[model samples]
Target: MTNRRSFLKGLGALPASTMLASETGFAQGIERDHFSDIGVKPFINAAAAYSALGGRNMWPKVVEAMEYARERNVIMEELQDAVGKRLASLIGCEAAMVTGGATSSMTLGTAACITGTNEELIRQVPDLRGMKNEVIIQKSHRYSYDHGVRSAGVQLIEVETAEELERAIGDKTAMLFFFFLNDAKGQIKLREFAALGKKHGIPTLIDGSNSVPPLSRLSEYLDAGFDLAAFSGGKGLRGPYSSGMLLGRKDLIEAARLNNSPHADTVGRAMKVSKEELLGMLAAVEFSLSFDYSVENVRETRIVHLIADKLSVYKNITTKVSYPRTESGRPHLQIFWDKSLTPLTVEQAQKELEDGEPSIRTCYLALSDGELEVGAAMLKDDEVDMLVQRLGQVLAPRAG
Candidate 1:
């Protein structure tokens, strides 16, 4: 019989490292090799994984897993298969696959619904000349991301209600596309919309990209009877920015993998998720599932109070720390002032902050009223001091 320690050793787990100093701010290691060689500079990220700012900072385990994956070469198919099964179990889904990002998953998942493991159909997609080439969507659900499904050469049929959705689906209707975050905006809710898809024999796909931090949305969507779903691994999970997840029926996920990278002559081949990114995403999902939301909320709340406390002393300025867990689930510090009483406009103040010595990028609230917002999720303990000082300098009455 194998000893417990021996079995654990054979499983290949690495030893854990001790936590490092936090209040000192960005790790010293990044500074030692700071990108002067490439004429690039890194700045503090108060924007929180906005896609334009390097997709936020990843957790230590996530980065470690990526490095480990990079140091070795393996069959891409095998790694994705193993990681996908582990990920499906984590989210309580039937199956899962890692993609280049959420948008890539959308495209691949769309193609999967369109083709469904038919090699000829897969190769002939985005040219859906003689196939069910229409995807149904709520008119209000038509955000800028509609292009992800459209790229597969399917036409988006927009509707306003359950009746409209019923009218929209026909022999040519291929899928029902729902943007989960915008549920309030759409007339037909997830359950009703999914019911319509099932009623009409159409596959349902939900874009749940930013629906994490309460990572249970993964299981929630599948449990609600939706046939397919996709999520961003980078946003709240802190995975590599390049990774996302597609989960659904085993057959759909397998069809998606067939259309995904490592398989040439398919639309998804260009949307390649590297082996390192796959492992990083898997590690992130595992970490996020057990991540302490209440503890994080407490820490972020304290950060918000610290910033608000430091800035409340300014004349004619008002600061409030507000956060609704339903929206972003992080504490935000908002500072407002009378434009006539201040020397700079909100835009000017934001520009000043953005052009500061370390180049801070903050979330701008209302510009005409001199309102600015800072999210505590991305703020380092030490950077909080600099932010407080800078805001005070720009808006407060200065003495000669």
Candidate 2:
């Protein structure tokens, strides 16, 4: 609903730097195929941190830290331990460890609760013989990522109501897992879920990832009584693709480290995180902590509004720059069209964008009639123009 002039305030100061500037400078130079050498093609990201798009861009500080780390020699164990302490301090947690993404954090955290620094037990995982193998999870919260906990060799017990949760927890329950992102959809609320874990004396865990601006939710779970938590380092943190942050109690964090890389013959050995990823995660956390997220939300909002302003000329198209009330705090552009007024179909427009020369990706939702949602979080300032141009070309009516 924003008018063109009303949305033009922050537009002038917006940076127009290329999105792939750093990535373009490959080791072999311009003509050399960096990504294409392996038959991979690059595209502009108008979407959020979708894993298929290789996560978000790394923070410049993160990149610098990684480059500096690549030239130095330090003990892997020592580096992980130090980075964990620093990150914990930055995130307001008792302890934290850099993991191999959120799923890896789930696996490691599950392993920590199951084994807890026991070398023999660490070796005996994915085969939870003579162990408390059941992990209680909300029925609504049960999804693909639960497999991460399962990888640590735990059976998931799904529940819906408060009564069902209490009844589900028994002698075999190792930990109570909650998906923080899906809290609104679950019957058991955050405080209630944490209270449930506290009541049962069972350690609680949460997938506290995908938090956009105002990242106070990072520590909110632990403060609410969760014993351990995992957040994506690559998503909002803008770190290396393979990295994640695990925050929780010192004992659990120490145990998680034992069960992760630099230690062979463990379930998490395969989920190895490199030194570069470790430093990248550390720098990303630092950047997030020091950076003012308020400005970021405004920048994202302005970017989306810019797209909306450009699309305002279309006859049947209505573009609203909005921030999902209960979901991601970042601003996004939602475009709805009156199909009778325009010949373009939602799928057709989406396909054309994806299949075009400078391929642009957007969230294509079939939310009745004709609609599309495009996230502005990962858009480089320059890509905003390309997205608007491509979208205009796709949605514009054919000439007579």
Candidate 3:
């Protein structure tokens, strides 16, 4: 295992500017004591919390928000309620609530759908000894995160198509759940799914943790009639990585709150959000909405173009721009390579890049025809130059 402490030293000396920075600066000011004393070393955060990539770096604004909240204390419940109300207004939902993260929101939301605001039943979740424990989920929508819902103690009945989903709903079906990313795999769309739940008077829920890039995705499900929806705070939103939001119908959201934090003796109590995290996440939401995605794209395009311009000297390489789907506009980048001309494989190139001086973290995507895709999102100002230099050296004619 990599001794992360040693890695910090390898980044050379911490910059003087960092000396003045605060301890709660990691991932938007969550006050990471572990890293605060150690701080960030020099590694490209390409993996972006993919779990495989070790997640992403925190946004500075998020850190500031966390720090601001830490200074004073307020009633945690009141703070969450106020934040939820503000978030509801912002997202055009009937109500909203923050949770530990996207998964927490899912578990809590499912639990609420299972018990509503009933005190006795809420505490008896997952026991299901004598309750409506079934949750209707499409066969195609079963993803890793479904465990969160199932963790609430509901039995998940998998189905496909409108007919199957409708049939699955009954006295035991407490909620109909949808994983947004799997929309492509499912035959039913949000409107159809929501309608099925509505027809039966059952609540409909959606897990949209990674769906924010399109930007409008935030409002898409709400407008489509999902009774409850959850999204991540860390990734594109730049909030605390450990935080997320659950938003939807007022009564449902309220029920979710009663089942969750700032209180006790329920499933969501263990996954509480600190006042700092709550405020910081809200600030991140505001900042994310206010960001000029188009300008950010233009900036990305320039960096990618620069890298491509330098790499163009090599033969058998072609560079093309790639864009991420997002409401803020999307990330712009350049993809370089032509298999016939280069003797190296994409994996070999990736290894070479990761092994080079100053080290470079490039995003890789495999094509149907076997090509490597790279981007400019996580590169620092100096790292960009290092990237071009290393790629040039690695691709240059090698001696026998």
Number of the top candidate by TM-score?
A: 1
Ranking by lDDT: 2, 1, 3
- Over 4 Å off, model 2: 1-33, 36-39, 325-327, 341-345, 364-370, 398-400
Model 1 TM-score is: 0.88
Across residues 230-317, which tens digit of lDDT does each residue of candidate 1 receive?
Answer: 8888888889998899988898999999988899989998998898999999998776655555556677788889888877777767
Model 3 agreement with the true structure over 1-400: per-residue lDDT tens digits: 1122321222233332452253234435355566447864455533234434544345567677788888988999889889987776666567888888889999999999888899898888768888889998889988778999998998899888788877777788889999886677789977889888888899989998877654456677877878888988776676787888998888888888888866687888899899988998888776565554454455566777887787787775567755543213244444455545556776788788777665566654431124444555555556676666777666655544
For model 2, residues 299-342, the per-residue Cα lDDT tens digits are: 78888888899888877678876566323667778887766555
Residue clash pairs of candidate 3? 27-58, 28-62, 28-63, 29-63, 47-53, 49-55, 139-159, 213-326, 214-327, 215-327
Which portions of model 1 miss their true places by more than 4 Å? 1-31, 324-327, 343-345, 364-371, 397-400
lDDT of 3 at 170: 76
Regions more than 4 Å wrong, model 3 = 1-41, 46-61, 213-215, 324-329, 332-352, 364-371, 392-400
Show pairs that collide, candidate 2: none
Count of backbone collisions in candidate 1: 0
Clashing pairs in 1: none
Q: Work out the TM-score per prediction.
A: 0.88, 0.88, 0.80
**What is each predicted model's overall lDDT from 0 to 1?**
0.79, 0.79, 0.72
